[model samples]
Target: MNAEIIAVGTELLLGQIANTNAQYLSSELAQLGINVFYHTAVGDNSSRLKDVIKGAQQRSNLIIFTGGLGPTKDDLTKETVASVLSVELEHDQKALNQIEQYFQRTNRHMTENNKKQALVLKGATVFPNDNGMAPGIAYKNKDCLYLLFPGPPSELKLMFDKYGRSFLLEQLETKQFMESRVLRFFGIGESQLETEIEDLIDSQKNPTIAPLAGEGEVTLRLTAKDNSLDRVTEMLNKVEEEIQRRVGTFFYGYGTTSLHSELFKKLQEKKLTISSAESLTGGSFANELTSFNGASLVYQGSIVCYQNEVKEKLLNVSPQVIKEHGAVSFECAKQMAEQVRQTLNSDIGVSFTGVAGPAEQEGKPVGTVFIGISIKNSKTEVYTLKLSGSRNGIRNRAVKYANFYLLKLLS
Candidate 1:
């Protein structure tokens, strides 16, 4: 299962955007037990791409390509790949209909060049893109397997996950299904979490542990392969129990769950609605809570008090409180939270007030933050934090910290 991920885009070479497709595909391939040894990115040039493909063919059995599937002339991935496979391109009528319908549905004229996207390698399996115009293709030529995807990550990700994955599994004749569970954790660094379960990672055999860190959180992906689904579940749960024994305090939720989403669940279970009064974070704190559908069950509303006047006029923060302790102070944060709850008639209220900037406010340093929470009858609590990052990072972390505290308080 040796594979090489070839990303084709002049934009990628120019550093206009990241080659995230490579990273994503590599991770998914690993879950399928495919060994991705090389990741190569080339411009829209066919000769260079051909050379890369020839080299990949010499070493790898699976060649997966992303990018260059578009209406423009610069999009040459399919052409280059078809040439390498010694095949001609033929129009896929379904793909053509998709493009035609897309243009008509959006009330835009379909150009002649746009038809180029409907062309696929002859004798290739076509994956119709639900999100975009270009179609993904897969062809098994002798001993080598080739999969091509659209350049845009949105299209590529959906096509691969929804259709391409199953096709690959069938091509590989995989009997055992690979089951994966991602245990998400906050308030724990990757190194610390790994060290706590280093022995298990060291002795991994049937179930494998991979630790990944991203944006203020860490996750351990436990993967197990077994013919029986129940056996795979048992294996993963067994590993999870052992890991939880060591670092259960930080474990929050599972696969793709965020801190805010987990907190939203708890609020729903308690049948309590929440609101927010935000300052330095703007409406970001509220935005996080509302990102999930049905969040309104637990989230009432929010007030973005960017200025002192707004705080006084809308959320009814006393002018004296602002003058005495400043807007970024803990006293002001608590008052804002309490006032928002009273104003919105929500069961719980949260507030974020911070100096997240290039300059300090009220003599407090940048990244100085105070997150406040108010329950119906409980005393209002404020968590003070001195974080370090860019202004956006500081603001983003404020929302995360708020979610963390709310989860802990509820627990």
Candidate 2:
């Protein structure tokens, strides 16, 4: 069944808060085979809210409302929905008792306004709130279903999982299982990847293919829907294989894998330790890798040698080489990688050196970068890039390049 989520709060419109509730609900609904077609955020005004609710009722069979379920007068979600549906509001005795007991346990006096949370719509199934005072409601009118949830995420999550999930599943009779697989790729643009797989995507029927690009990477999500879970998984596997066959060299780990994490995975699997010598990137590559848990096993450390003196003194690059080719050259990057591996006595070494600025440096133009990778007893290779972006952009792309190069060597 198709659904729409309505978030009620002025904080969202004013940018005081983010609408994370919609993101969470949409993901959960998708897993249940329910399509969330629209997301609407309205302020605390009852008139505007009533209009939104009335409009949603016409197009959507299932409407989930979040926020404005509190004691204050501004918390008007239930009131607005009741008015829109011409449903009577009545106080639930069990909910009122629970609220009173909570206040008694805390040794505090219960205010009259607090009882407003106990009010429920006539013929609605009351969802007991274990984490908050405001009880939520799920009710069906004619052929439409309305679900009310609390504003706070902690309370809303518990109530929805405890009660709302069963209600929706029963109403829709959603019994089919859906499976999805994500294939991540780097060193290739989204348009290029899509072009290569255009025929496969056009020929898709049972397993659908959708490409998404973000932050220097592209992902293809393949989804298959079937009544039997194993059958759906098998269908997704076949589709994934076909796509990978065309562009598998550019592909990395599957499902939420990042470049740094993928490199870290290889390092751990081989039981190999690595270190980095950072120049243009200023240790960002190392920082990203170390952010994951238990990174110490694969990552030794990093040295940010932004100056020629540091490169010469710490990494022991020959002074003559710097004078001849400059620090941003291919030779300097290769030496930086080899020296760091030798100095730290690591199994692998990676390096980044580039000109990242609005102006050129050392006869090299801005966005000129060289990424070096060195493995023990193996030939060191440097990948040159003439990227286009600001300093941070260049540095970010350089890091990705460094990881991609290292991943290629490791693989």
Candidate 3:
């Protein structure tokens, strides 16, 4: 079904609030193999809403409206929809009873205007709102299906999952299941990844590949639809295998997983503990690692040695090495890693030292980073990076690189 989502709120237009309801509904609709063509947001004005409704009726068969379902005068979604469809709004007895009971349970007097929350279009299927006072309505006028939901995310989500989803499913003549897999990658640019799989994307039919670039990472979402679940899974797997074969070296993990999370899981599984020595990153690596629960099991501690003296005294870097190579050198990073591992008695040690800058340091340019990893019973390893961005961006990317290298070591 071709769907359009109408979000009715002046606050959304004014940027006071986001229309998250459209995002949520679009995702849900995708799972059901329904394509959402447009998302239109209108202020709480009946005339503009009517114009939007008319435009939607010409293009989409499924029109879902969110917001403007409350007791306030600005809540005009149902009223405008009723006027457009030439149907009268009538009070649903069950909804009226529920609203009265809620006020009674709270021991508050129900104002006359509050009764408007019980209004529904004539000849509509009323979906009870378990979390709020406004009941959702689903009505078919001619060939179009109009579904009205509450603006609050909590109420809308619950009502849609409990009632609205099933209603849509029943209306479908043939049921088709859709599935998606998101492959997460780092250390690769989005354009480079796309180039590697450009053929697969260009000639795509059933399983479509979409690439999205996020903060220092990229993801490819592969979606497939079929009548049989097994067929859908097979189609998704086939596309994913080809994509993996092309750029599998950059692939780290699956959906919603980050470098730090993957490293945390690996450390826990291997029963290894780690410590960090931070310089330019300023303990950001340590903070990211310890944010996870039970992090103490895999994390010993961190030493933030921003100053040359602290590195010399705390991490025991030789003064001669600092004088010769400076603090942002590979020699300093290697020594810092080894010292932190030995001092904290951890299975592994990682160090981040660099010039993340508005200005260069020790003749090294900004974004010059050296990461060192010292694992027990293994030789210390250092990786040098020349990056670019804001200081905070460089720092954040450095922390992620630390996690990525540690994850590689543990793997």
Candidate 4:
């Protein structure tokens, strides 16, 4: 089934808010094997919204809308959609009662304008919003399915995941289901990865290969459509194997897993604990690891040695070593990693030392970085990089390379 998403808000066009709803809906519809051909955004003007809806109905079998379901006068999505569909609007008693209960629970007086939120188009299936006052609705009229949802991300996510998806899935009757696997890679450019598998991509038919690059990483999304889950998995494995044959060295983990997550998982799997001595990244590596739940099992601690004196005093790096090789050198990085691991008594140690720029430091160019990882009885390894971008970008990429190297070492 083909689907079209319409975002209704003046704020979106004015850059006051981003239209993230279209991205979410597109991904969701793709999982259901529905092709999302168009994404339309219109301001609060009802005539333009009507035109968009009328245009969508002529081309799409499903039209989904987000925003303009609030209490203000500018919230005219429901009214305009009702007018276009030749349907009447009536206040839903259940929705009105829920709105009243919400106001009562908060000890706030409900305004008469709040009643507008309870209005639903005639003969539409009401979707109760557990997260907010504005209820969603799904209806079918004239061979097109129309769905309305709130603009707030949290509320829209909850309503769609809880109710909207089930309605669409039931209405959709496609035998083929699309399954995708995202393989993430670091230390390899997107062009390099694609070039390695150019033959496979060129000859692709049943399973498609797509490469994406961002923030010093590359990802290959392998999508296959099949009725059976096992068949799709097998097809994906075959494609993955072909790609891995050429660019396997850079491939790290799969599907929604970041370098930090994969590093943490590898640490836990190998029963390793790590300590970090951070300089230019300012403890961002440790912060990223701790953001994942249950990271304390593998994360020992971190020391943010931003100052030269702190590096000498805390991580036990000699002042002469800093003077000789500079702080962003491989020698300094190795010492920092070894000292931090020995001090914290962790199985592994990681260090980030870099010159993230606006300006160069210690005669080293901006974006010059050295990441060091030390393991038990294993020689400390240092990876040097000359990255590009602003200070924050360089720092972020440095930390990511640190985790990527740590994962590789653990493997």
The prediction achieving the highest lDDT against the true structure is: 3
Give the Cα RMSD of candidate 1.
5.6
Candidate 2 lDDT tens digits, 83-160: 988999999999999999999999999999999999999999999999999899998998889999998998988888
Query: Model 3, 1-411: lDDT tens per residue?
Result: 889999999999999998899999999998888889999999999999999999999999999999999999999999999999999999999999999999999999999999999999999999999999999999998999999999999999999999999999998888888888999999999999989999999999899889999999999999999989899999998889888898988888999899999999999999999999999889998898899999999999999999999998989989998999999999999999999999999999999899999999989899999999999999999999999999999999999888888877777
Candidates sorted on TM-score, descending: 3, 2, 4, 1
By descending lDDT, how would the candidates be arranged? 3, 1, 4, 2
**How many backbone clashes does every candidate have?**
1, 0, 0, 0
TM-score for each model: 0.72, 0.96, 0.97, 0.84
Badly placed stretches (over 4 Å) of model 2 are 203-205
Steric clash pairs (candidate 2): none
How does candidate 1 score on lDDT? 0.91
lDDT of each: 0.91, 0.90, 0.94, 0.90
> Please, what are the lDDT tens digits per residue for candidate 1 over residues 1-411?
789999999989999999999999988887676778999999999899999999999999999999999989889999998888889999999999989998999999888999999999999999989999899999889899999999889999999999988888887765565677999998888999999999999999889999999998999999888777789889999999999999998988999989988998999888999999999899998888888889878888999999999999999999999999999999999999999999999989999998998999999999899999999999999999999899999999889888988888888
Best TM-score among the predictions, by candidate number: 3
Q: How many clashing pairs does model 3 include?
A: 0
Better of 2 and 4 by TM-score: 2
Clashing pairs in 3: none
Alpha-carbon error at 28 in model 3, in Å? 1.8
